[model samples]
Target: MLGGGGLVAANVYASATEGGWGGQSGPDATGQVKSAGMATIDCPDVGSRLTNVPDGARADVDRALAELDRQTASAYQQLQASAQALSADPHAADDSVMNPLKDKRSATIERIAVAIDRVGDRPEGLESLAACALLPGQEATGGVTGGTGQPTATASASPGGGQGQGGAGQAGAGQGGNGPVASDYADITAVQPNAPQPAQQADASRGSFTSDCGVNANGLRNSDNVIVAPGVSNGAHHFHDYVGNQSNNAFASDDDLAKADTSCVDKGDRSTYYWPVLRLQNGKQERDAGAPGGGTEGNAGQIVTPKQVTLTFVGNPRSKVTGMPRLLRIITGDAKAFVNGPANANASWSCTGYEDRQLKDKYPLCPSGSDVVRTFHFQSCWDGRNTDSANHRTHVAFEGPDGSCPEGFRAIPQLVQRIVYDVPAPSVEDGGRTVPLFAVDSFPEQLHKPVTDHGDFINVFDESLMRQMVDCINSGRTCGAGGDGGASASPSAGTGTGSGATAEPTAGASGTPAPSASNPSELPRTDATTTPAHTTKHSAPGEQDGRGEQGTDDTGRRTKQGGRSGHGAQATPAGAGTSHSAAPSASQAGEIGQAAQSPEPGSGRTTPPPAQSEPQAVHGGLAETGANLWPAGLGTLLALSGLVMLIRAKRLRY
Candidate 1:
């Protein structure tokens, strides 16, 4: 019985260690022995003979066993702490401290089982069994003995035998014979879910886009280029290299172009070459390209002279010794009507007018039946790289027509015009400046409005409303109230009647004198003791007699006050005999009364009560109470039962 009990205890210990019950001491308390039929147990007692027998091993085992108890206690404390934290704030259930405590509790339970197993057949083993009963898998198993008819006898082929006879012999020696049996056990204690670990703070300085490329602005590198070939032309082929290079020439540097090269070749030839006219800095024509005296035949009433011309070379030729020269070919008649001869029939073309009008519609004399009157102009350079490989000649033929220069009048060239080239200064407006263009149609409607200032547009309406409300409130008038209550009229004019009852001067008020108009019925009522009616009359001095007929009271009563009394007995006072006596008008009285009473709307007056102050009683509250206590309570009961069995095992001699 004692041997079986010891084996059960060892099994419990192994389970506890393997399943994380062996607490936070680091090394597991149950020393795992490699031998299939044996276990190495360590405890404080038993001399060297048992110590080396894989049963008794070291003095520290007692300390470990005691620490196991401490860990178990800690586990309980952590559970209580977790419960309290969760109760304080459900959000606190995710706190960090709860995880380690939970793990330690599980580890401790395993260690306790191992410690009990180590003290097999000894007094300490009994205490270990007691602790194991509180943990998982600590159930006792029936004992096996030999044929001697005594429970301590060793097993044999015979039903019963003496000690040291068979498998029963090892059992009688208080060792786990054929190893410990596996069994299910109660958990040491239930642990809360592992708390979330703190997120690792990221290093802000590293891993940034600007760190890779020095270009900090949200734009592509300036060195990137976009090459655009010719679209169309009218007379002889005319090309304007905006970047300063000639046709079929490479740019100075990769960055010289704005984007990738686009070839319109192979697509059927375009009809026009759109070009913007170069506006002169002084806004005046500087040059003219026309025939000398009278206009040439077929070109009547045409201004052939170019008032101003600016040509920008977009590319560089290989040789610097004698740099590429400008090539200009001018045709006299409508250049657009001239068809491409066999040599250049397949070349692509397009035309654009100087003022952005469609080239096809603006010029009427061009080919392809369009209004664009085109003339051919061709220019090219040869550094041994010629477009016509078959023809070894360095000179390349170019076609130009009026369609190429939609705005400029076409004129016949007296001779082939070839001018040497130099790097022209950048147009004053374009130098060292960059402008970004976006698809205007893609912008949101709110952003497209013509606002005086972007910031003001965003703030105006809301700001105005707030300012008005504040002014009204500070003026001693509440909002949502209909009209102004009876506040002070003015310090400039005295409290009595006449034209003095104007509102107090606002900040934006004009300083103009009040007009001498009288509306006696509209005047507000004052205390009865004050003057009844004092009319403010304006006139040139001595124009009227001091006591003249006009000055006499209309009611025929002599003036007793500083001014003459009003016509008839004192006119019935304004707002007399009415519940709205506070003001001359009932509307004004109602506004004042409302302002004095109710609070503003939407003031959070109907907020719901907090849940904490009134704890909701959950359904099946009794079941919840039992469920919460089940783990710890059941663990204790099992551990205590195992202890009793261990005690009995020690008392029985095998």
Candidate 2:
């Protein structure tokens, strides 16, 4: 079913017997409909279904789809704003929100059909999908209640309508009156270990390559989604944490990214890696507290800097890997999974000690000594033709259940991302009365659900580095650790074929340098330079960096990192700019909120500081700085169900 269309159909059938959309059966308690509550708009996901869009028409279609999303988002916000009117008269929902939204979508959908028809065949029945339904946020759709027996925050009132205030300096509830209730998390210790071992053949390429990009301590963030909604400012409703490329923004071109400076110790890697920022709902506001994609977009609270971010690339279990084409873009999870269904959901959540028990739908609740972990295993099988597809996904896919590529597809080195955080465990049983909750930023209608957590990547590895990565995996050589190229490890190191549980690719094995002082080897270092090649500006505690906070300048260019720009609104251009610019500050850059770039390096270019070793996670305390070994074949075929709880481990002081 499309966007829970079946639920809407059920409501339609029930209306005849129940009364109306808000009608109720004879009630023993109240005469009102027992199901009356907050609702969000749900419609068919047009972009996901368009697999055959012509290249000539792709741009037009993408813009149309993005407009459709914007329309839905605006309608949902209006729905929230009119909560009182809707509760007073259910017809208000149709008159003010749903009907108007349908008209807008119909016109947009027609444009899409026409664009495709000009180059290919016109799609029929798209008009039927224009209409949407206001499904109750707590009903038929997966639960949003936090186990407090209260309905989802969206069903309550307008934003800030009695939602709890943030902890300190922050403005409102960390959830921005949207979600992340008690029901979103589960205890990791109570979860049964269900991680299945990948069936590797004798010919499996068991080697792994790791790239140590820092934890984004520089605080680079944005709301632009270059892959899905390029050129549109605030394309992603929520904020995203960025590392790897310093020149990335909605308007950044492939050449711009290729020419950009990298945060990786190996300068050859200019790839861009980003994901929705995880925020501590404790209400400590960062600089974007009042900016678009921040507090204004329902993403509130202090953004938690990742304590450690591990980027690893491993080989296929069934075949030799090939070098990924440069500039290949991959999106690993579904940002709209909460409403789009679990069909393409790929989020993996767990604690360090309990990684064998991964969860997808719920956030994991870890015990006192562990830290929260989020992992993303990108789709590894490429069609061997297109680097990207119309849907931004059809060009790449996960291996079959048998761990083999589909016909015409070839296995490339799979990128496995592991991010760890030190957060106090929420008291879910008591509804976070003691500890504040944490959640990933999400589209407003998604209600900040855990299932919506996702990541994005764009491979910019130079030809030489990419070749080395491919060779390392295919030859089963554990290269890149200890700053060594083509380094060989014990044959059985990463094979997961030995006798003990340690044989199953734990964090301190193989060529992956352990967090030991005596052995200071790190992962994927082509050079041993300890100092960063360039300097980057970072905001002081409580200060804001306008250029990095998703705001654009007068011409709508997102400035590089530097001082916060004047209060510039997020740009919402229909098409991306053809060139990149570092405009002056908002005060000087005209009425539009274009921002100035961060101060450039001596070379007159923007580049990130070099990567440094991070604190590795120990069972009970913080270990010294070293590369943490992730499983060679992680997140492949991993199932998602429960959520995770963040526990405060010993802090890893810089």
TM-scores of the candidates are 0.13, 0.67
lDDT tens per residue, model 2, 1-654: 222343444454445434211121122232211222235677788888888899899888978988898888888778776765666676668888899999999999999999999999998788888998876544211122221223333353222121453331111123466666545676555565556557788878877776655556456678889999887888888888777888888889898998998766567778999999888766565667787777776787767666456777888887888899988999988998977998888878876555656778888765433457788888999998888887889999998877799889999988877776655456432234335577899987777778889999999988998888888877876554322344322122221111111111223111121222321221122221322121123333233343353333232223334432322111211121211122211122111122223223222222111111112123114341122212211221121111111111223332
Name the regions of candidate 1 deviating beyond 4 angstroms. Answer: 1-297, 302-304, 316-322, 325-378, 383-394, 397-654
Span of ten consecutive residues with least summed lDDT in model 1: 207-216
Model 1 C-alpha lDDT per residue in residues 1-654, reported as the tens digit of each score? 444455555566455544221111111123211111111111211111122212242223433333433333333323223433433453332243334444544454455446546755332432332221111111112121111111111212111111121111121111101111110000001111111212212211111000000000111101101111111111111111111121122122222221222111101111111121111111111111121111110011111111111111111111111122222211111111111112321111111111111111111111110111122122323332222211112133221221121122211111111111111111111110110000000001011001100000000112333333334333434221112332211112111111111211111101111121243322322232333233223332223435232322222212223222121112222322211111011111122102122212222111111011111244226876576555445555566777788787788955
- Clashes counted in candidate 2 amount to 20
* lDDT (Cα, 0-100) at 327 in candidate 2: 89
Error of 2 at 283 (Å): 2.2
Going through the candidates in the order shown, the clash numbers are 96, 20
Q: What's the lDDT for residue 211 in model 2?
A: 63
Error of 2 at 95 (Å): 1.2
The candidate scoring highest on TM-score is 2
Number of the top lDDT candidate:
2
